[model samples]
Target: MGSLIPCLDLNLIPDYSIAVTPKSEPKLEPLDEELYFSTPNPISNSDPNPDPNSDVIQEFSPVSDITGEESDVFSQYYRISQLFQSVFARKLPQHSDLTVVDPNSLAIVPQPEETGVSAAVLNYKKHSRSAEMIRVSTLAVEDARYFRNLVRTTRMLYDSLRIFSSLEDESGRTIGKRMRGDLRAASLMKSRGLWLNRDKRIIGSIPGIYVGDVFFFRMELCVIGLHGQPQAGIDYVSASQSSNGEPIATSIVVSGGYEDDEDAGDEIIYTGQGGQDRQLARQCVHQKLEGGNLALERSKYYGIEIRVIRGFKYERSITSKIYVYDGLYRIVDCWFDVGKSGFGVYKYRLVRMADQPEMGSAVLKFAGNLRTKPLAARPSGYLSLDISKGRETLPVLLFNDIDSDQEPLLFEYLPKPVFPPYAFQQLGNNFGCDCVSGCSSGCFCAQRNGGEFPYDRNGILLMGKPLILECGSFCCCPPTCQNRVTQKGVKHRLEVFRSRETGWGVRSLDLIPAGSFICEYTGVVLAREQVALFTMNGDSLVYPSRFPKKWVEWGDLSQVFSEFMRPAYPSIPPLNFAVDVSTMRNVACYFSHSSSPNVMVQYVLYDHLNILYPHLMLFAMENIPPLRELSLDYGVADDWGGKLAICN
Candidate 1:
């Protein structure tokens, strides 16, 4: 009766296919080294499996949105598409024991047997080692020493697994299963052991790890949600599950709380020495986000701040600046740029900041230790402390020796401490704008192009340099405004047009001279020490970074810039710096390739304006053309089609 009942909806049984699974057979021997990296001989496409064009089940009907908004349907399609991709794109056959009856079919099959412990461990360890080796070898660690260490460690673990397997009981089925699982877990732990290289000695594994049945990899990814924080999502894709599967990535919704707050917000409490409310302005973000710390995003985390009453005096003729982390620590001293080029110094000590008499005595003792000069200390300077007198005196000590020029200011130190700038200081406007003091008539701000040139103050250009309005009107936001200020070199080309009575004409152009000074790019200058404390990797460490582009380091100028600057602008001539060839790019420009020619492209030497203030005189090689609308090449063997392949 049940077989006959299906006659009404006979079409429901859609055509599908059963994919055959090969019987498992252990290899006769362990894999050879060559087989580890053997070339994949894929089954030729011409030799298709039986019913290769068919599927094992009816394709799942895509869920349609009855409510037909274009956006809603599109979104539904996207979600369904992703889910379908995840299922069908699996590496191993998605289902087993199924026959293909239809070409275009889909169905939900019972889950396959779990990838047992042995298979999982083997795949996971191989995948893990590959990723680690790739990253370790790519870093500037001199050749592949780091990668070698990883390979060595992996080999050692492989040996351990072999020994553990031999010791297990082959006859006790239950015990054998447990023993294999234990060995798999051990192998995983051994692989992860390399991550602790900074502390662990190469002596041996942590105790009990070899004996234990635990592997941290089994722990599932944990999602943590903090209150008042943005909703977040994290996806951990296993390396085996990805296309190519060579490297797996774990991306997360980086919470804002973990990052440093550039604008010294409520999380940062600035208490004065005497608890007096004096204004203390935090160093600008340009300084905070500089140096090796260039990758740090400042708007997310709370900062501990301790500042010298006058930090520059200790290190320079100017006030010495010391960053006391988090309003609390008298424990660590983070010294930053003292305005004197690259001289940065740091030290640590404990300070007591409390109200009791003991607290004062403790602070005084700490101050005494800090005041102690090194054997090489110059006789010209010393340290001083200012204490707020309450029930107990709170001591505020300087990091370096105070200078005579700054003595009066220290003597005039108020009982109250100056509060650094708060995050909310200007909710109306963004940070860094309060830089230029006062309001003036028609001050309309420097138009970056019109009225007064902003770089005029820095004096890099001798008042004759052309001004471009490219660096936005001063009224723009910081991000946009900074980008405008960084216009330099070929990037600053001006579009000149000729127009007649029709207000437009054939805009015939003229040639520019080689070594011509393009418009000056203007921006702020920061000391190298400041950058060291603030910036992260990937951000430039040059003292005079123009927003996104950092100035090349003097040491690296020849090696790094030579490669980057040569043929950097396809429309312009190549620059002569001694940089690595990896950085050069071939761009298209005017070229009349000739077996022999009158004008030959040659490397031209152009002097860069001092990077400090009023970034001016961005010079690029141009032509002293004897003809009209012609491009000249810097003729050199390297510049001709080899390294400079873009040449004509």
Candidate 2:
């Protein structure tokens, strides 16, 4: 490749001015030994002395200031940022067992005999070409599934790099310059021909992405074909795609970058690209009807719809801004005008298309208001402010908006499962890792999880296994160990709301990222023999065997891992216990059943080392928008008559 250019930072020379170049097919060549083993550190722009020829881009602050209350609201996110930094600084474990690849051949690498984390990494590289071929030939019907897999795989790869960066001996010094994870990950995918929607351009919606989908980085938008330009606010198709041989606008990002940009819920006053002195935050020259400006004019004349993505300052993120796909919009009106800086600028009015989902930014704003002032935002439906009665860190709101003020059948809110006496007696000696700081690569707990940390630095599960062994009470590691994820109780603000169709259900007041731990299925544990008795007596009993085998599909790893290289987890004996949440339950009890569920049940063993009695933890299966109902597959027919049994 060439010297890497920082694309997402708008403070750099505008990336919009760079023409979109078609990616050439990758030719097989001998892998550069230095490139594979030692990635050069990106040139630093923070040097006191200047390199006149170096197009160095410094990191820019997206937001000027954050209020105290806002800081408090996003305190959890700040902790996550710190956690990521610590993980990055730690030395990754050496993996001598990894299979070495021949630099001269492009043939797929053979599966390694050792089935560990390092093996998985090699498998990912080996199968990249195969996965790219499948993605390129993907039919429209498979677009949604393919897109989801691509996004998940990209993030997983990026996270893996951050935690497992190449190191130089014991000093914890990384081999190369530390770069932004998103950029590095996206670049890797692009070089390997893994990016989708490359050969053709779509004028309207991308098939797999939804209206309210949330993206954390600008490169995500580029890789997913939502917005082709990494930093450019405008995305358009050139003259080749048009009948009149003129470019047409396809999408634009309204991120408050231009002073003239105005965002209304269903409408946006979008400022066309260019004619700005970004350093001075003002227009310096007249905006010409060329490039994006001309494209927008052509789109309006041709009655073409444009995609509108909105960006907001996200206090809970390291990047500081989140982009939401707000659906398609038409360029209804366009005009040249004298701007705030008294310079000519192009302005366009865009009206959102009809029958789309609620504006994503509106939902975020509403959730924020609800968090700050619950009484004012939702004045009516709340039944009890704190259903846990101060037991939980965050309040669990009980609401009834459908028909009656009737609360759920009275029950104790149990945060953790209560095991029967015999369940504990069955446990062999409990063990824990002895890392005083935090559980890392060499920790015993990580070893138990196939010689790699089960989670990434940010506490997101890296992959789904038959069982995840977390640090227990016996560990010398601190309570904040990345391994101890599910042990932490519900992190999101949840609500038990009455649904007109599904009875009582749960929804989140925050955006839940994919692989994020939601909560545990807490209840009174019963012996396996007692399950049938409880079911016969009309008690709500959850059978561990009844949960779907969706773990194999969690990270979409089938694309990379060959059949043999995939983790062949030891068969976990059938669970000897069942949880009865009918009388004593928590928020997990209200999760409704869905054929295509957003939440997945992960079997985790942390409090104890017993495999037969692993804890049932719920995690978000994909990026869930605020106020969206949380659901899981119950692994039963929809007509199943059991009432409470279906919800858990």
Candidate 3:
């Protein structure tokens, strides 16, 4: 095979400007062995399934007339063509394994498996294809416009269909190099387990994963050491965990927790005896510890596991085990360093993906953690629920999924939600133990609170972090179980107040402590497509460049301009759903925007998993004084980096 690519259609090259001669042979150099691809072309009849990649074209089929000077340009097109043809098309490596493949005979290309950090590698050999592609797009291409068109169109169309974009041309205007990089950086494809979008500003941390001190993570090196954790020392080792019993590191499989790590505190490290670690300050690392560079570096790949060393379950079978592979977490950062215990340690944080399956054993083992005591769980709502109902002066946060659009309370008519219909949803499963003993080990309902109620006597979240599992109707216990804190509706007094900057905002009527469980944002749950229909101005919501057309046509003003004069910010995704409070809502609908926000929305996953939407549970990030405006950082910033006006 001489040519590594099929003869692409002449008309199909959307960005092609001039003609190409069939005589233009590939001037591609033997850069390295890391490239391979396939495209269908003519094959012999004897072998029906010939590898399209097996044969290569020696001479090019002329797409259009080309100049003699353009021979070098074709080589670049050939390089990128390889990457464009390839897909993941393979299973993820198992148990931290890496593999090498042969590019030519399709045999393994030999390379040393044992490579060390800080060893300068032949990067040109490793990144040759990317370098060639970048060169062609940057230096070789005579027309910047042409490069922009082909690259952006290909990226957008390929992403939208979740397949190769065979189409040469798409409808909208093509983005330039700068815009493409920005959009790509901001973009996050959870299904792909990758984040490369560079220009997008991240305003918050992934919940439970980056809590407390280890707040700085962005796909780079990080450090984590389990030396002096509170439970044991740094790594949650139990006193019984020793060489004679279980290794201290192994004890983390059972006794380690997220809170313990946060409370363990920082272990500062310096370059010399003095503060010579300029690299630390330059990176603005918020945590003061370091050391675990290898674990952090290797974890950047998709499907790689940031094993928390907690007990989840052994793979392939469902049985209890100490070492929990806390799903496949991305390694945002890691490093090497010293500990606060006056010893060397590594400190880094692994952010849990927003949603994923737990280990099979972990799920089953959780069923045994509930206590026999009566759960204090009860219906969640305000004490004045009866008084607030149907009142025009203030909003009543009804949690029911009723479809009624009640009268306007502050700005316009908002639909009031009754509390989440958990009681009714629970009727389907008998996982709830008999209400008499509350939730017990025998009751699968106890898994909601790790086999115990999640709250103290005063109903505060026991550790300020919980995978809340409120007792459903299936529970044998009464509704007042302490495990039912989130279900026990709005305890904080809040009211809607008109704002000069934002349309309306919510303010606390009483003081609220840090980490307080605030009210959930309730409304008619609708898919992204459904939200687009009513939202006139679709400019406020943050979305990838590829999704702008789906939210609203930029060229179409009437479709985007709302009657209120502000651009509508409808959160859009391929299928992201929104909780529409336009018709009926609680005081949460009036929450304003804050760069340094006091509260943020967290999806509570317990019994029912609504794939279209997670229950948007709001939690206070810090203490709030009485009469202070309650707000959240919605993460939709404008070009100038200011929070959008519609966030309130």
Best by TM-score: 2
TM-score of 3: 0.31
Q: What ranking of all candidate models by TM-score puts the best one first?
A: 2, 3, 1
C-alpha RMSD of candidate 2? 12.6
Task: For candidate 2, write residues 1-648 as lDDT tens digits.
Answer: 112221111121223445533211111011111112233323321222221111122111111121222232222222223333332222111223332242222112224564433332312222121101001222443455455556655544443332232111122332223345555445445544555566455656665677888877676776677776655567665433333445567778787767777888688887766667655656767777766677788788867788888887877543566788988898899999888989888889999999888888888889888878888998888888888888877899988877764555378888889987655553444367889977766667776776665676677776677888888876889988888888878788998888777788888888887778999888888886788777786756777788887676654423322221334453478766778776788888888876556788989887766677888999877768788888877776653212354352
The TM-score measured for candidate 1 stands at 0.17
Worst 10 residues of 3 by lDDT: 127-136
Error of 2 at 296 (Å): 0.8
Candidate 3 lDDT over 48-103, as tens digits, reads: 22211111111111122111222232221222223222221121111122232422
Error of 1 at 624 (Å): 49
Question: Where in model 1 is the C-alpha error above 4 Å?
Answer: 1-111, 115-123, 127-473, 478-648
TM-score of each: 0.17, 0.74, 0.31
Cα-based RMSD of candidate 3 = 24.0
Better of 1 and 3 by lDDT: 3
